[model samples]
Target: MAVVTTAVRSGLLFPLFLLSIDASFQRKSGTKTQNIGSFWNGSTGRSERGTELSCCALINVQMRQVFPIHAQQTRPKKECRDRLVQYNDQLDAVLGELEHHPEILLRAVVADGQYAKDLFVETVTGHGFALISKLQRNANLNYVYDGPDQQRRGPKRKHDGKVTFADLSRFDVVNESAAERILTQVVWGVRWKRLLRVVVIQVLDHHGQVIKYAVLFSTDITMSASEVVALYRSRFEIEYVFRDGKQFLGLQDAQMRTQQALESHWNLTLLVMNLARLEALRANNGAQTLVFGVEDLKRRAYNALFAQVILVNLGLEARFEELIANPSGPLNFGLKAA
Candidate 1:
């Protein structure tokens, strides 16, 4: 239901790569809780575990957006953050840093609860992808069924008030392996598109453990249920950005006192990360790129993937020169950097 950011590691700040940071509030927004930790000067080199404002990002091929944008939950953890959309002009300030033209090719986006309702979607769609986000996964959506075309010569159920497109109070949803009927509802998309709503349900197994999931999606993509899962699953990879950033990248150390400093620091961190990923993308594909299990990334190569970003970020032309200079050096760092 809610995702909390875990750490900020050492990497490039992604100016355009979106982050899906989550948190469990240690202090209430309005209930008055004083700052509890020593202003993290990083002398100890770690976040002082307490009330802190931070976030993370995820990337998926199935992501439905072109550029990266940030979306926040309806309620920001800190009231000061509640007006961030207005405060920072809805992240419009960061657009210049991205330097993306046409505003429609933005292949990545970042978001959390505090983000305005459709900020991420708008940004990504502007670029050219359809991004499905978990930040507002359950926000109520409204739409009308698109079974027939508009030109059909018949009484329209929508205009005539005789047809019910979606019923929020009731829905029918089924997961792969379950006998109990799940209670679902219509969650509409921002645009009142005909087929944008979906059916979602949370079911408990025999062990009394609750596994929340959705039945089907209404996006324009005409794929099977597995495809939908695969598409949405890309969101998990971005989630790992939060985990890896907190541990390997310096996301929270953001020692600058000014708000711009913090935002700039976070964005730069993601840029560094994207630089590393661009290298990997030039080399690997699919599972290799998304692989993040500790056992997997812990190998000297994978650790280097997150650790030796400085070397990896070196341009290909420079790398070739280095290879020519020292053939036996660590040019063997990544997986077949051909």
Candidate 2:
């Protein structure tokens, strides 16, 4: 939270922050490891038979830059888990960190369809944040009753009728393209028991027929439909953090069995990635557009370390600056071309 606050204060990051929440499974072994259970392997798109740790993360997305705020293990199931912490409970832990930094302008909390439950939505909205997420295609939704009420009614009518996706004429068409159509309406969610600004995306085929559709909703009814769609799309940026951590930062390489040791390793792995991103942004000096490649950063660091070790071993440390000053020297050996 301090790092995020500093970035916002220093003008490196915008005041608006969109919190993206998701979980990833880390493959682990050994009978002594705690909280190990069958978790969904996103890479393989299936539940792995082997034991794994369910790590949930909160990422702050601003344009192209992603800042990882918190990550911890959550129990995948309540039946066999010793310490049964639900996903919503782990999310509350992440939100607790944000509460300390009230100055940060948080716009909304975006998650996937898995978090579209009433409890999760209430948790996010309770934190004074607008919850934006995907809902089931056939979610139980009803149009808000806008007609005149009866003069002698016992109670006012709340819902008019069930919402039908095939008949979007009642809804407002916000966007249309060759690929899909975006329609929105302020309706009452039966299951959620609240008003929702729902966006229905009707995907089109080559012949312009409706092949399938998706449903996205936000608690903020005043938010525009296009903005909701765009924000939900940006939620995928958090997945990159998990990808880089596992591939380059050894996110699943921990050998520890205890919860504390594993948590420390997970935090350190993501923290290093966050530091690297901050360094990259600092090097760019707040440029509007800058290419950030983690692989290139790793390559440059390796080259610098290799050059420093060879210079010190050869008793040529005095000439290190001159050697590195040369553009074609060892320090620049394997860097990608700009």
lDDT of 2 by residue, 1-338 (tens): 66667667778777677877777878887666777767778789998743444344444455556777766666546544433236677777777777877777778888899889877888888888899999886899999988898788589988889998878889998888999999999999999789999999999998988899989999999999998998898888888777888888898898987778888898888788777877877766752565555777898788877877888999987887886578666665666674
Error of 1 at 222 (Å): 5.9
Among the numbered candidates, top TM-score falls to: 2
The lDDT per prediction is 0.39, 0.78
Task: Write model 1 residue lDDT over 41-148, tens digit each, in one string.
Answer: 233555443334444334434322111234221233343444344423434434443343332223434343344245545554554444443434444454445456
Error of 1 at 166 (Å): 14
Candidate 2 lDDT trough over 10 residues, lowest sum: 50-59
Per-model TM-score, in order, reads 0.46, 0.87
* Deviation of model 2 at 266, angstroms: 0.2
Q: Candidate 2 — which pairs collide?
A: none
